[model samples]
Target: MLSKRQSKYFKSLQLKKYRQTEGKFLVEGAKGVEEVLQSDFEVEALIGTSAYLSSLAENLKSKAKETIEAKETDLLQVGTFKSNNTGIAVVKIPGQDRNVVEEKGLILALDAVNDPGNLGTIIRIADWYGIKTLVCSMDTADVYNPKVINSTMGSFTRVNVMYADLKDYLSKSDKKVYGALLEGESIYKTDLTDGIVLMGSESHGISEELRPFVTDPVKIPGRGGAESLNVAVATAVVLDNFFRG
Candidate 1:
């Protein structure tokens, strides 16, 4: 069982302020905790119910510094999840290499994407499309946000995300820059692959600063009545076309 002091520590990590101050965050639910454990990340504690602890694989338990048994109510009280179905993991934030991604293969970039759910789904989509490197603008959603982590459903372990000045990165890259816009060339006709694909935010599209760097403004032709496709949905569509073309 987690003590009062420990519970307080876990609960404190729910907010971004504390997460940044302490360089730690929470990964809740069985699948999320399992994925973190499977990765190289260090787990400080694994708090779960009796059934959950018993059901965990031996290798999974070995990854954590300590395994703690707690009641469902206690976990729910401390975690973001309304119901603590399985467990919550206290993980130390892994150090990242902040150097600009070298233009080698297809690198995915996000420009001012503030939605956590969209960010998470985009991470999953990047993983599915075999995109190892992801760059986000400074204003993009926090990758460590609890909602984003939960939405990734474990794909967070596979994709590498970095936040930087989008214009600086785009200005220096020699590779082709493709930005998704409403008034751009058809993605169907464009032979797009092996370069940086910049996906903008839903409401604002690409920022003006980043706009000057886009060498090729690409668009997915939609014959329907929808205003615009969601960022993740558009990313998937673009990647699908890239794969086929």
Candidate 2:
């Protein structure tokens, strides 16, 4: 039985305004909820249908501020979006700090990657290769965007995604910066080290303002004239080639 306030709160979380006002976001599905439960995030509430609640009985002792068990119909009633039948959990959005990247192993910087799925896929790609830190331009898609969360396939738990002024960070950074361009030295031939690999937006390559800061301008060699590759695909190719080698 959801209280009237709980109903209102769940509805509010659907909008970015409410998420910002409350400093929280929503994670859905069994995998996503399990990721949140096993992560360091502070969960606020867990609401589930009776069927879902029974499955989580062993771990449901208020991992959050409140755990409410409701009938399947009730859980579906006030759900902000289509509840995937796996239940829903709300967790505090992790506070992101860009300065931490300066001391980390390898950090990825996104210029203005606006697609939520693309950003989420890249985050998953980063996690696949153990690249934990990500710095994005302010214009990039919000990591907490539900679409992005869904796309990460639970990799969000292991990755830290932050937004910053990419140009300024690149200019001030001590790490070697490599920018992927269309007509530069082949990425296969470039010497990549433990540093930042700057990936650009979907439509455009690295922005002009930040291109000057690139220590090594590299390109992925291709045999065909396909114009270019998808940003997330390009990221996976670059990270796999460098990290697997």
| Candidate that scores best on lDDT | 1
For model 2, the superposed segments whose C-alpha errors exceed 4 Å read 71-83, 96-99
Model 2: ten consecutive residues of lowest lDDT? 95-104
Q: Which stretches of candidate 1 lie above 4 Å from their native place?
A: 98-102
Query: For model 2, how does the per-residue alpha-carbon lDDT over 55-114 read when each residue is reduced to its tens digit?
Result: 874665357778877655555654534656757788887665422664568888899899
Listed in order, each prediction's TM-score against the native is 0.96, 0.91
Clashing pairs in 2: none
lDDT of each: 0.89, 0.81
Q: Give lDDT for model 2.
A: 0.81
lDDT for 24 (candidate 1): 90
Tens digit per residue, CA lDDT, model 1, 27-101: 999999999999988898999999999999998998999888899988998898988769999998877653346
The TM-score of candidate 2 is 0.91
